[model samples]
Target: MKRKDYALEAKRFVDAAGGKENIESYLHCVTRLRLNVIDKTKVNEAEIKDSPLAKGINWTQNQLQIILGTGVVEAVYAEVQKIMEVSNASMDEKLDNSKLEDFKLQVKANKETLRNKSWFFGEIQKGMRVLGDIFVPIIPAIVAAGLAMGVSALLKQILNPSGEQLNSLLWIIVDIVTKTAFDSLAVLVCWSTVKRFGGNPVLGIIIGLMLVNPLLPNKGSIAAYNAQLDFYNNQLIEGLSKNEIYKAWVEAGLKWIGQAPTFDANGNVITNAVMGDPITAIKVWIIPITGYQGSVLPALIIGVAVAYLEKWIKIWMPKAVNIIFTPFLTITIAFLVALFIFGPILLMVEQGILIATKAILGIKYGFGTAIIAGVLQGIVITGCHQVLQGLEMQLVIDGSLPGANGAAATGSIFNAIWTASIISQGGAAMAIAVKAKDKSDKELGFSAAISTLFGITEPAIFGTNLPKIKPFIYASIGGFFGGLFAGILNVTCPGMGVTVIPGLLLYTGNWTKLLGIIGVNIISFGVAFLLTLFLFKDGIQSKKTKLGLKFEQLKNKIKLDKFKIKRKSAE
Candidate 1:
């Protein structure tokens, strides 16, 4: 149905239920309509069941629950909220000051108080946090350098096939862009993570370069020195800065003292350090560092400390930590975890996966690629399916992984289901549209028909066919068979982000792949329709027609004339 019509029809159902005054509390969890009502006696249960607005209703003590299929619940909730004020009711009949009453008052007072915060800011933060958890650790070197390599490959294919093309004038620019772009993926992740964590992102970005820093001079030299910076004669040295020296001093002092330490340097250490070489100078100045270690490893170590500390703080000072503190704590915790744990773990996993792939499937790259893409796609899409689609685009753009062959394969499987679902429901929708005794079913049929064609099956699934459960099972079974066949056939697809149908052209160039795609679509749809027809009763074949009632007269008798809208002005 059109959005407005759906809203209107839902409102009709609400108006039928004693116009919202009968409802005590309203809530939706996952799928079903969970409600608490004031006067159960006043509800017309038979009217609702016969009206076609609800598939079924069940009364379980305090709750009045209704079933509307997926995608339709949001519209129902939105319409009901407009017509009524559903508040939580206290269970304790004797309690003078109930928690439910207090919560109701709080909700009334705090309407739009929290959500007035910027949506864009929240979305950006959420996106960045997701990236930090999934991408930031391995991003610094692998993705950055890989993208650069992709460009280099493209350039090499086009302009530098052999050694002869390298001397060309354009090669210099291509070489620089490709080389630099490849390694910047990690840097981007670092900066984005720091930015999300409320740090000076510019500093975070610059610091990320330490991974590829030329200043270290030798491999793992900084780690070998335990990141100790040496100064000479109380003057600044070339390798270590004044800040580095200060940090080293603080760390050394902290080690000597159990608690946080302070430095007293005006007389003894300063005077002794002025006359020595870098080693002697550092020795005279060193004070066995204590608590705060600001180096990367130490920051990570402290971050682990902070995680445990925050838990205590939360309980110790509950009033001080509310929703407002969530962002701050999240940032701090993420910063430490990313630096210490996530970075190393992600790097190791990514490296191992890449190395293993190269070793085992370097020759049959296509087959290996398809299996990874198809399997992961299936698993990821089961819950909030869109996440895999988003990740596929990111990985491809980052260039560490090959293009989205896995994504395409998985999407194709899902798409087969979508198409089959629409076709299977077509007969049912037509039946309801043709011979339903109630005007409501005819209207619902019109909606189910359109929604199914566009790959939305909720209305048909929940409203007409799916409550029976047989159609849904059949659709999924057909989809699995069709999807598996497509995979085994090596139906290669041109990269089209995630949506499978959009990449149909990728298979167009090859007749075998094209034929396979067509075959899968046909099989899935045909099987679904046949199963649905056999399992479900035909809605269109009316006994009233055979009983000598004229079609137009029957339709006219059930025709909907006008809708009744409730007046909030009276309330």
Candidate 2:
């Protein structure tokens, strides 16, 4: 067999896709190289599909996706990016007036396509891709932290049972590893968000640091701080409430700004007349803005606003003064908006989602669990699964969701569903591998299925199950049952990030839950495999054709090698 040259293949891919100039932007998710091209008509879809390196091709959400297996996709993407940079540099050196006009025209066409009714959904899909790009870079650190926390929990159960204090260096190490990433999650999120939104990442870091400033009261201390503040001149105010404290702060602000508050008939300050309804509401919910340590949405919202504000400032200010003014105005505006408006609103939204999730997953007989598991893969296909990152992180930090019998479990129920869905995809891929008659098809299927065991299903989903519709359907059905079983057992995950094989560390202290998770995987795999084998016929026939071709190629290769040896001996 000939060794594959991924770099060469990547270059060919670039040319077939109408060169680097045609590419607007490109990104990869697990298994596929997703490219947004300036002109879809210019892309040679047939050439891309015919490439020996490409496992499959999919056109979805207004992006061209070329399926390359998990690890291979990353390598191909790097090579492609390198090629584009070299190509672009060369074009810049030889640039002329007509070429410059052409470049501008291409940019204009790209912008026009964004507003076209045909491409509206494509633009929305790009939003999801942007979200993925922001968080994907930070995932490794988060996953490592979660794993460390899980290990610490396990050590506590084994080494310090019954709450016996065993203060040791080992415990300190565990604590450091567990807290470092999670405690400063906002900082990481801010850096990534700002970079994605085309702003200075350092400004994003400054904003993130402010959100989680050491001087700010921690979330756990907010209540005590509020109560302490309720005292005026060291005299405790009787019947003091959070609302009253907030009102006092707002009134103090009014006075500082040289405005007098108007009172109503009951001697109460009319909040609407003083600062309007929206600002009043913001003030009331201000207590929740202490820190965004475990939050995602708030930092993202702030980063977006900062990016736009910085751009606007640069446009209006003189070049000589813009440097100083841009950073100053950008941070000032972003920080104030985050502190007073977006932060509180997003906090409430986060709380609401948490509350709603608990209610749904806490439903009788694990109905919610089944539904979430069943639809989760579909969500991933549509690129909406990134939304779960924040939810899963919050759930893991919260430790456990409400369950029956007042029993608090030690892991995330949401993660359990994710685990089931991921494993089911692997199972579906594996079944296709088993039923495949062609050597190439079997290899692709087996590789994709194996990749899923490590909690990466893009290879399995895009390379195998997606192409065979019935397998995907069967896998989803398997996921639902697996999730149902997990919910019934009240399975909990100790952390987020890694799922499936590596996720076992999260259940170190709870063997029963671990076994239940294993059972879920087995059941999901079994159901998906059986359903795909019995129901899908196209997969079987496709394999047979490919296998026969492979055999013929192998025979021809053997004959050629023999002929070469004979000729060499005669010479």
Candidate 3:
């Protein structure tokens, strides 16, 4: 639905959730506002779900997650906070107090029922929530930067070839805009992580900057240099010899990253294989000083450790000396430990994960990638999708490198997989909308379906498809088929973070890949739509309930009683 006033809608949600007093704390992710309430039963979920503003609602443990799509969720979250602040002074508040005793009784039964959920999965979900807290806040920034880079790449392709006057000037400006976010990604991660853990935001920013200081060797550059050297040294190129064909090409740009080796004890130059000949061993930095640029794991670990340490520092230190000593101790201790201890350990772990992911997704036939494509949405459903955040970001970082077009197209393949799954769920919702006999069901399904095309899928999943099990299964099948084709075609994108229709921008340089993802969209949507329409009867809805009428109808009953009292006096 097109929005009314956001503040008024926030009031509706707040009122439906018993009252402002029932809420304890709340936070928002990309497409949902997760609120922790003192009393779960006080939340009139039916009213909230039926609201024109809400796409759906679900609970993970005690936290109520309301899916409001992407653009609206943030606005509504802000308004809700505002509502909480002003609610006390408002004499006209419409909170219904009639359900108080019933709510208390229901709260007990709700607790007993909630305990049936698996304790193991609950703990795992809690960890995933922490990951969500760290990553989801920066999602908008990443998406914006990724799209900016997409535009820059398009500008470079179109204007660079023609030697237009605007080419270099425009490209330089856009390049600067695009590179800043990913170039300082570790800093963002640290900042988000510390904020998630309840530490001071300023300290988080300081620690993050320390992790990515300009004085240190550039991490991404060194990795690129090493990766190229390893590929040449291993002689893995089949049917073509790099010695004869690539020696000149290699010398064109690869000569400056390392230096000649020192002589060994016997006065012989240390040598290693290069291409067809042996050369003096490449002397690189022995004592590493590289800063993590596009890394997430190192910053994540350091953020957690420092957050707790800062809390500890405050426990015993005299408040008198705290002003002088706190900042000094935190910065110095975090800097040294990050460099010498946590940094190395976490980097090694990050390297292992990166290598393993590349090996699996980079398999010869794209079989491994195809499997990931088919099942990733299932992972999303489990709320374990947060676990893949590192993998997905690494893919985008690797795929955006200069030579990735000639590589296996890892980023694009993973993106296509993601896009396929997202849109398939949307297609299923669309099918339900199209075939529904009830007007309310059609409205619900249509709203959810349309949001998914913009790359938000939780509404379609939670509000429509998952409640109807067959549609969810059919959607996954559609994704599998679409992703299988995407894998075979080796579709490529410059980056990730956007998908479906808007995602088309990522492939603007290549017509064939663009057409290929278009094919993915059509196939995934078509299959899911066809299956859901033909097989599912009556479409997606509860038989008796009207989503948006519940709360309003309840309020109307109170108005009717007051009117009856007024009429008796008039008679």
Candidate 4:
């Protein structure tokens, strides 16, 4: 029906149902009108159903539902709100959106206000979007780094038997490639975050590449290293601070000044009438003044100058602000936030988590590594996996954690859980495909398989397993056994991710140990699938619900007329 007719249709229904005063709280979910009644006697549900408004009548677990599909429910809800003089105490608190259009406009304006604040926040938002976009691709890159390094002896032989001719070039190339990939992971993560937020991906990539470029001399060390060698001192000091060259210049000047005593008044060498303290004053003081100018002092002066300039820019930028100026402001704010806020917060969080984990494991005698691993394994995976990534990157930068342990572990977990879920769900699907009688059960069986593969287990869990009792029992039993086995193996994870199986790659150097972990997961999945199949075969077959004799009498009348017509036509 057209929406124009809904108001009139709703008014008629409300009037028939005791002028809406009889209705108490009203809510809607999916297919039904959830209405709490003031007086059940006043509500003629049969008449309400017969009034050409509602689809059907049902009372389940205290909910008096008026079923209506699609547009009809919304139309009815709107009209009811307008004419129905609802009692405040009896009304549902959530049926308050009478002026939805106005509220929507207000919400939009508020969002715009926030967006207009500064360019910096916009950049942050952009970075977040970029990060979200590239989150998946980075996984493969991380895995490649690990694979290039030797997996344990079982997976890959690091020590080759043939000593005939070692390929030094290939070895060197691989080493360089892996090292470079591992070193710049952070820059990639940050750049991706920015790109996802709508900034240029190429720009972000450029920035990332620059941040970790090892070829670029570190600002602090170049000066010190160049000062020792004469050839390097001349060439490299040109690039270093003035202070670096000032000391060298100061010493040469002092040496010349010291010998000035022998020079005559007209710049000729006086020989006998030498100055009293030309060398002492030059050696002790004048050179040091020039030395300070050449070194850190100039850099410090420049930094102060730039900082004041930035402060002044901030003060003036807001007055001349426009849409174009917005990007510049946002970029500035984002840079500050990245350098100050995000960077420090990430570092501290990473350190805290690492410290806590180490402390847990470092306990003497009383603590079991496997038990600690099991307890923390899931907890850390939820949100704290980022912590491990941060720490691992920090370690790599510091020359501590080799390669990318954090990323590798994450991959292993993703592969492991993914494989186990697929196998288990596949088994359930096969069993249901063969044994289930009811159409709903058979359909649910297929859906369960699909959901499991995608990592959303709610429907499979709550709808099928928990309700059936047998599947739930088996799954819990399986989870417990798996947890126990995982605990016993002392499987240590330096990283975390989605899949359970591939996460075993975190222990790549210990291929035997990884296989042991994989074996345990398989056993868990196998036990759950086998037990569930054995217990639920009968349950699947006997799923029909017998309505009471009173309700059963109405079945023929409720059945669609098409079936009746077809039967009569056939006869």
Best by TM-score: 3
Compared with the true structure, what per-residue lDDT tens digits does model 1 show for residues 434-464?
A: 5454454456555654444433333454444
TM-score of each: 0.31, 0.51, 0.51, 0.32
- What lDDT score belongs to each candidate, Candidate 1 first? 0.41, 0.65, 0.64, 0.41
lDDT of 2 by residue, 489-550 (tens): 88886555556776665666688988988888888778888888787765335533443354
Which one is best on lDDT?
A: 2
**Candidate 3 residue lDDT tens string, 417-442:** 88888889989989988987545457
CA error at residue 70 for candidate 3, angstroms: 11
Give me candidate 1's TM-score against the actual structure: 0.31
RMSD in Å for model 2: 15.8
Q: What are the root-mean-square deviations of the candidates from the true structure over C-alphas? A: 21.4, 15.8, 12.3, 22.8
Give candidate 2 misplaced runs (Cα > 4 Å): 1-121, 143-153, 163-167, 217-287, 354-362, 368-483, 486-571
Off by over 4 Å in 1: 1-42, 45-473, 494-501, 532-571
Residue 56 deviation, candidate 4, in Å?
5.0
Higher-TM-score candidate among 1 and 4? 4
Model 3, residue 223: C-alpha shift (Å):
2.4
